[model samples]
Target: MTGSFLPYGRHVVDDDDISAVAEVLRGDWLTTGPTVEKFEASLAERVGARFAVACSSGTAGLHMATAVAGLSPGDRAVVPPMTFLATANAVRYQGGDVVFSDVDPQTGLLNIDGVQDIVDRARNGIRAVLPVHLAGQTVDMPSLARLAKKAGFVVIEDACHALGTEYLDGNEVVSVGSCRHSTMAVFSFHPVKTIAMGEGGAVTTNDPDVYRKLLEFRNHGMTREANQFQNRDMALDSDAEPNPWYYEMPSIGFNYRASDIHCALAHSQLKKLNSFIARRRELAARYDEQLQYLSPILLPPLRIEGCNPAWHLYAVRIDFKASGMTRKQVMVRLREAGIGSQVHYIPVHLQPYYRRLYGESSLPGATAYYAATLSLPLFPSMSDGDVGRVVDTLAHCLGMN
Candidate 1:
């Protein structure tokens, strides 16, 4: 606890990551170049997806996915209220409406029942379901996929917290982001994620058309393919054709491409993703074992029979009444002890903007989660002593001897 202030989450950069970025900086291209393509390919291979498109951020990936899926004004996308605002904001970015769903009270993951309720109640325009994998836990994708099919909606997984998580089927661990159960999956490469790349994201899809549209959308709707262009005769019509630079903009898009520098860093981080996930799980186990006797705090729910979490966050629920201290007070006490603690989310539905949009009402599960949740420091770089200090400080604050 004496070294320095601990953060709830932090990036772990190595010499290789720095060298990779330096190499990219020295190269000719910086944006939308070979390094970006290599990173996309690497991610697709790693996730077992047919295609992967790199973007400026996780929100950008979500927006592109929604737009490409034909979400537009008056349409609705179902989203869990327990996630970050971006999950719902992406829907609004495409002029689509957001219908808030509740989360599981214990896991803070999207409640399948709430999602089904929203789907059944939709009068007309609901088009997609964006289920978030909160805190790096994998959602029940197979079951959700069945619901999506029955409800006639596209499934776009907001997998920002679950890059290394897997969906288990008995003894087999099926990798997430493989799009095995959804139309597409989105991931964030923010500094706090399993693999850090400063600021970037990607979309993984098995559909080729969706992949092509994502590529075009991420790059201002510009396409280099002559075959796909509207006017084929444009190539033959000009003498100085500018090396077939002639392209078409069928839809208005954004310049949301990730830079080569970030891609290089992300590539290096991806190489160590497995080990990072392993370490996170190990730390989570330590917390579970040590904190079991603390009546004031509740650990995150364990994995179901067919799920393996990436453990991107080590969130615990604090019972203020039992602990004799509110969440904020506990957080302050922990900070005084030189440990960093924070809340994972303030349910999106309760945010100022959403309050205006949806109005304040009873969201029992999400509100409950918001009131109790706290994220402790968790990262691969944390040593055993660091873990001990965090647990000890928390125990002291909670009066758990």
Candidate 2:
């Protein structure tokens, strides 16, 4: 049984998902259709956002937020170091500078002090902040939002890892993508995420004007609404009769539309999101209990109060100095034993692109976290027995005698 390779993450599709896609295949439209609107409305309601815009990918959604938030040339965004490159790269897509913020060394979540550090160090005009919910855990968004408001910069959440994840807002529990504490929040529907849509994403916002901008940008900065037209060519006669095909393209835009087929499948998957989060939490708890005896590896679970994390990945830290083994050696042995594992991240500031752009800088918190972080397999499809096998195999590979 231990010889069966288990991946760190995967999609858990069912017959309903297939049927939904099949129905879409037999329908009239494939790209922009009724299903897309339905999916956006359902998702917006689920996360308590006033509006939602489905897009081709999470990166596109982030770019939409940056564009709608007015990030342009000579603007900067402060982002955490421990995250996927997209979190920072999205700013650059809109011609904005990225300022690196260090995370808490143990939890890998950015904090208020880190924001202060960014303010003190950045020589450019910092206009926005992107707080990443790394490894399915949320930053203190309520506090962070307050800080942003006081500092006069907009906040956008990189909630790609936190779909069903929720946190306390005083007496009420709010979902990460609610946009309750930020200008907007982004979500991904990749197979490895909390929910899968094959390939899709969305941005959620409460601001009507921002939502309108998102709508225009996602579909090539064009609008079919007659009232929104800016050209006299749109008028047919002195009667001011509008052309049914009249549309305006005031600014350059890209094709970032999410197809109806993807939306149909994602809508089906969204129905199971609660159960998926429940199972992931169960697996995470099992790992927490079973791995307590394993030395030199620190397990990170629901460390914060009032956080119901969807647990997109179960990342822990291995103390290589005490284990007397290299990180590469342990990973090799685990792979040989059919137990797959991966590093959650390398410091974003240390990446060659960022390094070349900003030169070298010290970030002790991000460095320490990267030196020890490792992600173990934890998916909704994983059985308790499978988790036991993984723990036993990992123990054996580490030679925990």
Which is the leading candidate under lDDT? 2
Best by TM-score: 2
In the range 1-401, model 1's lDDT, one tens digit per residue, is 45678899999999999999999899998987999999999999998999999999998999899989989999999888888889999999988888988887777888888888877778994699998898888767878888988888999999999998887755666788999889999999999899998999999999999998999999898887766777656644456343545778877899999999999999999999999999999998888887777753656545555678898888988787777888878889888878898887888888888889879867788887878889999999998788888887888888887
> Where does model 2 exceed 4 Å of error?
1-3, 120-124, 235-238
> Which regions of candidate 1 are displaced past 4 Å?
170-172, 233-235, 238-243
Task: Estimate TM-scores for all models.
Answer: 0.96, 0.97
| Superposed Cα RMSD, model 1 | 1.8
State in Å the error of residue 282, model 1: 0.8
Please, what are the lDDT tens digits per residue for candidate 2 over residues 292-382?
A: 9885454554367778889999987878877788889988988887878888788889899999999997888899888988899988988
The number of clashing residue pairs in each candidate reads: 0, 0
| Residue 118 shift from truth in candidate 2, angstroms | 2.2
> Residue 34's C-alpha lDDT in candidate 2?
95
Tell me the whole-model lDDT of each prediction, alpha carbons only: 0.86, 0.87
Model 1 lDDT, residue 4, Cα: 78
